[model samples]
Target: MLLELAGIDKQVGADTWLYPLNLTLQESAVTILLGATRAGKTSLMRIMAGLDTPTTGRVLVDGQDVTGVPVRRRNIAMVYQQFINYPSMTVADNIASPLRLSGQRDVLPRVREIARTLHIEEFLDRLPAELSGGQQQRVALARALAKDAPLMLLDEPLVNLDYKLREDLREELGDMFSQGRSTVVYATTEPAEALLLGGYTAVLDRGELLQYGPTIDVFQRPNSMRVARAFSDPPMNFIEARADGAALHCQGMGPVPLSGSNLPSGAVTLGLRAADLSLQHQGGDCLISGQVQLAEISGSATYVHAQTPVGNLIAQVPGVSHHQLGDAITLHFSSRQAYVFGPDESLLRAPQMEARHGSY
Candidate 1:
């Protein structure tokens, strides 16, 4: 492991910030810390970089305990959301700042190499004030890469960029990671970004580590309802239900046969993803009828928002459909695709359902 954090905890003022957190970043892999704002993503990055110390636990880098090491002495590079560059200095000089600060007298070649790799070579002679925001950020990244550190921490590096530039830079960063063994710990709240990077993703909520695993495993088999909701776009749909003998009863889809046991009597929330719900011409098993309230067309596919007896739900339909608002339609889903959550909102695995039916 390039970076390891064990039993980490922190507090500020009245709130207990980060809970007992543990994570490891492997060499040449990109580990994304995903969560919403104020989830302590930035705080954890700062702790790992040696800028801040936790009230408990230790931080190890390449088998060395560096919990008390100062930020300047740590061999780690951090690129923040804000473009930190000297307005008076040219791009080349800005990229060379870290090398110069480290007492490396001959730094021009390394600076040029990093600039070229990040595609900012042409803007080397331009000052920070003369370049665009994206260019300035590239300079910041170039500076970070120039250090050739063992670990790179990025805090929403593409926050301010337009969609096109963000996608381009994402690809560039992926390529850069492929060429080296540097460990990367990127923080973002976007689910698509986490899936695209393809590594271990730790979902943080209110400073606590909720779920951590491979991106595919976490997305396909979420440990809890909260983890499932956090990973989806519009989030998973929850319908209050009950188990009646071998069938499950809900307000929308009533009396669907249950494939598992150990269900409580009062109330249970059933979760289904948008992709799991589809429009069916003829009603089949596990079907629910609803009125389309809204329709969103996004080029290749259309998203239909319908008002069901349970609540408002979203369904992803392939290509453009003839469905319109106020239209009555039937939404279909398999029993296996439905997830059952306890009253406390934790996911409950149904082994019988898994064995009887396949996932969509």
Candidate 2:
């Protein structure tokens, strides 16, 4: 393992912040610390960067303990949600600062190289205050990249940028980091961004790690309801269900013939994602009847909100849709795309589909 956290715990006075946890980070892949606000994503990053001391446990690198080492001693480069740069320095100077401090010659050429990669070369002579938020962020990232540290950390660095800038920067950063030897750990609250990054993920909720695995596996097979809710966009829909012998039963939908292994008997909750449902019901699909309450058009996709017997549900459909308020329509999704949860909110089985999936 490149990096590992053994029995890590954080406590404040009488309150427990992070439960005793363990994590092993891959050497040369991006790892996303995924969760919502107040989920301890930032805290863990801070701890790993040596800005804070853990209440318990140790931090290790290359199988050796480096617990409580100061940030400067750990060859780590970090960028935060808020842009951090030398206020009085030009963008070029800012990017070259680290190189100069390390006694590297030909700093100007290297600075321009990084600036061009981040698309901030035009603003290289401007002070930090003169650039837009996105440009400032790009400068900060360029500075971090210029360092070429062994470990890289980004704490919601793109969150404050505009939508277009965020999308563009994310793509550029993904490409840049994947080709480097540095181990990268990025923190984000957006599940889509994590999926977009396409790496290993540590799912944190309320300071507790719910799951950790490859990005696609954790998203497709969330270990619990908390992980599912964190991994999904627009939230996942659920219905009370029960397993009897070989058939699974849902209210209003009646007893449906579903195929799966270890089908938990007794009370369970069935989880469904909006993207999995089809507006044009295809064969081998289970049906859910509902009245359309609203159709939200966002970009090229449409989100249909509906009131059903089970509860309020949302469906993500492609292209322009004609769904109207109070119009009754049936939503159908393949049984293989269904997610079943036990009474304890633990996943009973993952979605069984193997075809290409439309993500949220």
lDDT of 2 by residue, 93-160 (tens): 99998898888988988998889878889999899999888889989999999988888999998887
Residue-wise C-alpha lDDT for candidate 1, range 157-231, written one tens digit per residue: 888777777777777777777666688889998887777676778888889888888766777767777787777
lDDT values for all models: 0.80, 0.86
* Colliding pairs, model 1: none
What stretches of model 2 exceed 4 Å from their correct place? 260-262, 354-358
Deviation from native of the Cα of residue 10 in model 1, angstroms: 1.4
- What are the clashing pairs of model 2? none
lDDT (C-alpha) at residue 108 in model 1: 85
> What's the count of clashing pairs in each model shown?
0, 0
TM-score for each candidate, following the candidate numbering: 0.85, 0.95
**Model 2, TM vs. native:** 0.95
Model 1 global lDDT (CA atoms, 0 to 1): 0.80
